[model samples]
Target: MPRRTLPTAEDQAARFVRQREADRKATAEDYVELIADLLREEGEARAVDLARRMGVSQATVTATVGRLQRDGLVETKPYRGLFLTAAGTALAAEAKARHDLVVRFLIAVGLDAGTAEQDAEGIEHHASDKALTAFARFLSERGDTT
Candidate 1:
């Protein structure tokens, strides 16, 4: 076995920047998916309801919702609930598919169901499409989708 050296300062900074971008994208994806799910489950996605489900302050939800609207992911009408734009719905579907792939890969690697679900939440955000595709292939080769 070979030992690895620690990351350099420059390497750490670059990685941090990349990770922050990924996290930002993940947050956007998560909000869209949550809105879609809430709409399906409750027929609405109000700021208050989103805050409750996300465990964040109403102010935070308002700010993020504003950003989403600006990004053309969601639309809000006065006195009405939140709604996903076509772009938002597409992103939510992609995020859901990616999450499913990550969870399946973790289970195929022998993680228990609970742990795989928990770990997939983080991995799905950070995993590249190439990596996820490879994971899907691995699972398919084994004839296992669960």
Candidate 2:
């Protein structure tokens, strides 16, 4: 194999930015899952309230709600609460199940909910379906999640 040159700091930063963009795209896929979990846990919620619960600004919640609405995953009305469509609830339930599996795995290895939820949030967005399914199977085999 031929030798390769070491990239300069600037070149490395550019590459890092590109990689970050790719990760953001993957992360955006989690919005649907996030909405599902929030609605499942809280039922109908105002955008402002959800923003408060999720530790985000109302603007951010509004934008995400708009996208979810456009996708038919949620319904929002002026001065009214947000309700998850049936499809949204189903999707969220799946995401929550996967999240529970991951959280259990993390706790099995000795972690807390705050940490587990944080780590699970990052993993849930990017981990493959097959990998999560295998993890769920592992949990079931251990008689934890069934």
Show how many residue pairs clash in every candidate, following the order shown.
0, 0
Model 2 misplacement above 4 A? 1-43
Model 1 residue 13 distance off true place after TM-score fit, in angstroms: 4.9
Error of 1 at 62 (Å): 0.3
Question: In lDDT terms, how accurate is model 2?
Answer: 0.71
Residue 43 of model 2: what lDDT?
67
Clashing pairs in 1: none
Output the lDDT of residue 67, model 2: 76
TM-score of each model, in listed order: 0.88, 0.68
Q: Write the per-residue lDDT of candidate 2 for residues 1-146, one digit (tens) a residue.
A: 99999999999998788667647644334555665555667665677666776688889987877877877778876666777788777766776776778888777668887899889877765566687787777777778854
Quote the RMSD, in angstroms, for model 1: 2.0
- Alpha-carbon RMSD of each model: 2.0, 5.6
